[model samples]
Target: MASQPADVDPAEFNSLNEDFYRADPAETIEHRLWMLAAFLADESTNVGGQEELSLSRDEAPYRKDRVQFAALESTLILHQAAETLLRLCLAHWTDAPCPWFEMAKLRQPRVFPKKVAHVSNTLDTDETISELLRIVSWSGDQDVIEAGVKWGYENGWERHREGLRELIRYCCVVIRDGADLYNAGKHGLAILPSEKGVSIGEGDVISVRGPSLTVIERQVQDGDLRWAKVTHWVKYKESIAITGKIASAVRSLWECGKTAGLVVAT
Candidate 1:
């Protein structure tokens, strides 16, 4: 690392320190991986199911409503991560390029019941932790590595803004049990399988699909999927404002995206 010249203005050093922390979450690879892992754990959450009746009440046995079970069920795959034996279930929708986005779906440090997927480092703890340490050390370079990290924070945020919001909303579902309107609505019970696969993207509202009706953030399921949250159509109406804001952000993002040659055709 090059030391600053004594003649250099001290203000330059102070300004750099101020902006760097603001960029820390993005610039630091460790933090990015940490956030990504957090997001993965978030979206991977599924609250209620038939056999899992922790949320049901005595008087209202076999309750079909889901709102009551706000506490809901939570299953973390393992005490270990990446190396543990667990099925790597890539959240897939169709047999299309949508498969690529799997990389961005951040997950947690959890080991599933079986080992279904593996990254080069995941199989070995020594290498994985060592590589992370290397990156941390690399960040000390300031010019070469730090600049690239800062660029990632700036660019990844700009590139995946809407995509990230969709991720964030799902995150809300995991962290805030009450906010999981889909899983926490009504009795938060089961009738049909909430096979309702919701794959929200940059310019889309999360739509929960069922055989009979496809609802956005609210719907009951019928199939092998699992139990679903009931929708209070009236209360959910207010979410339109939030929905609208997401749409607008996606639109602005798309418009700007074209300049960077990455526009998604809605």
Candidate 2:
């Protein structure tokens, strides 16, 4: 490869030269999904070398940092697995053009659809979840994906669809419970110190004074304030259970999808 001239505009040149968007083969995508599934299954060290059953900090034998990191990572991985599976379903099962929001992210030759671009420029998790629920809802009318699965897999998708619904419900609970804790890890976990700083978790109500306590100091710590500890965060055992459910769901869905994909391929 020849080195570019020092005077050339690097950003523009790189943009022009890069193959930003390439549609991966369905087989490759399937393989990636399986890899994620495997990661979820190997839960040997969810909270710092301790198993998921070790819920309380006392039994975990690990610092809070490690515990927090594992919890946050597992939550994120579960969400990603579900999102990717849904996207694959949309791509393979539906004939509708790719959502403009997704298209904008890809580096392709196709022009963006301006009219729908504004409305569909982002991958809405809620929308995807809703669509997935609808597909498996057992409604009288069959969606494209359902029809394809029935035609190709001969009812293989039926059980998987039921499993998916259960997994979806579990994920929703995990997301709600873990959202604040996960966000706190990314930002900083706000620790409120009081002489009575007993046990606390998410959603434990308390009182707050003017200008929330951002800073802590001996001199400024003069106020009778009360606030609730947020307890929505999932513990070790719960995290493990959630990941296990996700792994099972993704595995089942992938197997069924792959079989159906091959049938259609033939």
Candidate 3:
């Protein structure tokens, strides 16, 4: 016969029950943004480490591969974060109840940009930009303000709102460009490192180069063909740089939203 387990303490059990009940299990857009912020914050450390590795002279095996992987992962996170931020903005601006689950179902590349463009056309005027800047300035974060201003200046945008619109547009582009890669990564798509050779007719090679990583997909239209399609390619360092810009954009929008009372503190 098995020995009986020791009895649990009633007081301890009661305390645990009380704690569980006190915790809020409900999810909200604010909570989702907070979670994404936390994820990006964690990935920032990884990005820094990858940057260091890329600059180092160490000849470790697969060192380049590691950097490339970091870039891919960071870009995916940035795409998701940007999508969520845009959804939150749309919800607030339109006074519609755009919940997280509903937004998650959106075909980001196809649907999000059109909606954002419509809203911007109607509301992103110079006056509104001025109002947004005033609200952002109230946050007292010089870095956030300067980031948007600097980006605007670099793009030759005269108005701050133009810069803001550009930033959002860039995010949409990232989502569109990365859609195949993102879906591949999420859905067990086969990826590999590969190179393409450039040569003359008689095999006189000019050069050979390709993306650091490539995603492989079945050629649905030509299933009878022997070769699979190289659907997407990622230039590792360039992708990493793009991820940095996305992060900065997300931070600026978050700060602006918080200051404007669009986002609540979690």
**How are the candidates ranked when ordered by TM-score, highest leading?**
3, 2, 1
The 10 consecutive residues of candidate 1 with the worst lDDT sum are 77-86
TM-score of each: 0.21, 0.36, 0.49
Better of 1 and 3 by TM-score: 3
Q: Which should have the higher TM-score, number 1 or number 2?
A: 2
Top-down lDDT ranking: 3, 2, 1
By TM-score, how accurate is candidate 2?
0.36
Name the TM-score of candidate 1.
0.21
Per-residue lDDT value at 44 in model 1:
26
Best by TM-score: 3
Per residue, candidate 3 scores C-alpha lDDT tens digits across 168-224 of: 666666655666667766677455544444556566655445544467554455547
Listing every candidate in turn, what is its Cα RMSD in Å to the true structure after a full C-alpha superposition? 21.9, 12.8, 13.1
The digit string of per-residue lDDT tens for model 2 on 114-135 reads: 3123213322444543455443
For candidate 3, the per-residue lDDT at 127 reads: 52
Summarize candidate 1's per-residue lDDT along 1-266 as a digit string, tens digits.
Answer: 67633433443433433332232221232333333334334432343352467654323322222211111211111111111111111212121122123223324233211112232225234443232222222211235445554554555433443343343333233233333333322334332322234549765576554222112343345645554435321222223233333333333322322232222323
Residue 1 local lDDT, model 3 = 67
Model 3 regions lying over 4 Å from their true place? 1-61, 95-162, 195-210, 216-228, 262-266
